[model samples]
Target: MFGIGTYPRGGRLFVAALAVACCGFGNTGTADADTFIPLPGGIITRELADGTTITIRIDEESAKVSPSLGSTPVHRNVWVSGVGSVDLAGPSADTATIKISPGYVVGCQMDISSLGVNENAGESNTLSQTAPYITPSLSESFGGGITLAPGQAVARLMLDLEKPDDYGMESHKRYNKVPGPHASVTWVDEAFEVNGCGGYAQARSFVLAEIDTTTFIGNLALWGQPFTMG
Candidate 1:
């Protein structure tokens, strides 16, 4: 399957919902494979797995990549599990924030809730806010926001639909079928502080929302409904 889906002003609508579900899975290339490519100002086109392709040119300068249709125009060094096809060749760009370190995925149906972390904007206010894996120093870094120090680094979280849904709070409700469909992931923090360098880092991030199944319970994965929409 696939993962990483959540939107509400977090990088190109979560990379256009992972580029409209990126062709519904085919290249199960595995080996840390993750995909999302939607470029043209609100930039986002990442394929990270060592092939090299980056253009998260969010604020400006230095953003390049190759091979979407190919004709010889390779532009390397974008590092970190690199994968390509994202452009923002200037002209007052809009968005382009990229980073795929430890992992990435959004979903392609295993009955939705493909992966998760925290925050649908509820659950005691998402565990009392303030915890995006810490990272933000030098007087709160300010440009593209991320200033790593206290160990691990991996940030790409989006998903918060209004509030009052539960799970991770607010949106994670899907159910369909038998013997399968119930996924989860959570690791908000074992320790905090980024800029001042604290220690113990573990902030899991994955939320491919869309699981309603009449509110709660367990085992869910139903499809082809003549009626039902939550």
Candidate 2:
């Protein structure tokens, strides 16, 4: 599993930890299916379902590592998830049905972008309509949106984690931890549609990961015997 593991001090596991992390990407400049592209700490080199090749890597100088919030250590490992993904097929809704690609997405952070064909951020086109349906089980309140009115004009979903300092906060001990690892959001074979004019628009899905596990568990490391200096 690409799942992150903990570091061990002065043991074989310590060497092993570094070994896995050194897998070093971009050798072939691609990844097989279901592979994780580490965020600022890791990189993704692959083509999306749309055949657009992208690379995701955090510059060593820009990587931020700190003790994660709500951790016992409270002094180290503030590192978090990496961010990047392929642009699974997008659809433009037109009073019928909409489609999202590369089914069964799982991640802590996802980007959903929907807007008026002629509009930029915070601005809507005349008579454009989009009603985004987020999985009720997940929090859809991560981003700001205009309140729903009778046949509202537009809906937009955005998740931009490329900026490490701007990463979203997920309370470690609050929810989705232990005996279970669940995504903050999941879009499995979903379709959307618009009800008004302005021509329904395209949707893109990107993924981001957290370095800390959602679980409160660790492996038992065996130190055997303490080394003595002669």
Candidate 3:
């Protein structure tokens, strides 16, 4: 999934994010002695040394977040797209429990461009392509930077998802991006199956969302984490 915007361009830009899942991602929103913990798995509990239990969501499969942790785990039953959920704190103390369910497979969305590009009428530069990766894959360089001129622009944005090989090596590329500049365009790739050969495929999805910028004067920001499948 990607969201695009335009502004004066100068330097190259890129953005990335990991899939959101089990106690996946969270922020305290403050710097005081607090931790921003994400609970996406629908049911999560942090046991204190003194036996005080802190319970919360597992975060990967749902978007419905409570303002704060509730007392009854059942009340935290939030809704999610594509994933069936489990009950909270059901009668077990030592049994680490998990259940299987059906859900959509989300891929990585890279938006590395931000604030449009500003060309110097006669100057041309190449827009570089970021590398693609498989699960636990590293980033790469694919598209060369685009050349630009004053008052003229190019859509240097592209999102690619390649399926891994039979042995789990990636072998396909699914790229989505508007070829040119438009006001604001959002391209969301449909959910696809993950490379299942990896042991963690049933529980994790690696995602990267980046901002591509010509100049680094301003900041490009991305919110949210990877979509959890467990």
Candidate 1 per-residue lDDT, tens place, 1-230, comes to 11322222121111111221221222211111112222121233333232222232111111122221322221111111112112222221223232221122211112222222322222121111222322221122212223344333433322221445446566421211111112222221111112221222121212122211222211111111010000
Candidate 3, 131-204: lDDT as tens digits: 21222122332232222222222222234446666899866443322211111323332122222121111112
* Candidate 2 residue runs with Cα over 4 Å from true position: 1-187, 213-230
Better of 1 and 3 by lDDT: 3
Clashing pairs in 2: 38-42, 39-82, 66-77, 66-78, 67-76, 67-78, 68-77, 81-209, 81-210, 112-157
| TM-score for each model | 0.19, 0.19, 0.24
Query: All candidates' lDDT scores?
Result: 0.21, 0.20, 0.25
- The positional error of residue 185 in candidate 3, measured at the CA in angstroms, is 3.7
**lDDT tens digits, residues 8-97, model 2?**
111011100000112221212111222222222333443323332222222221112222244322122111132222111112111111
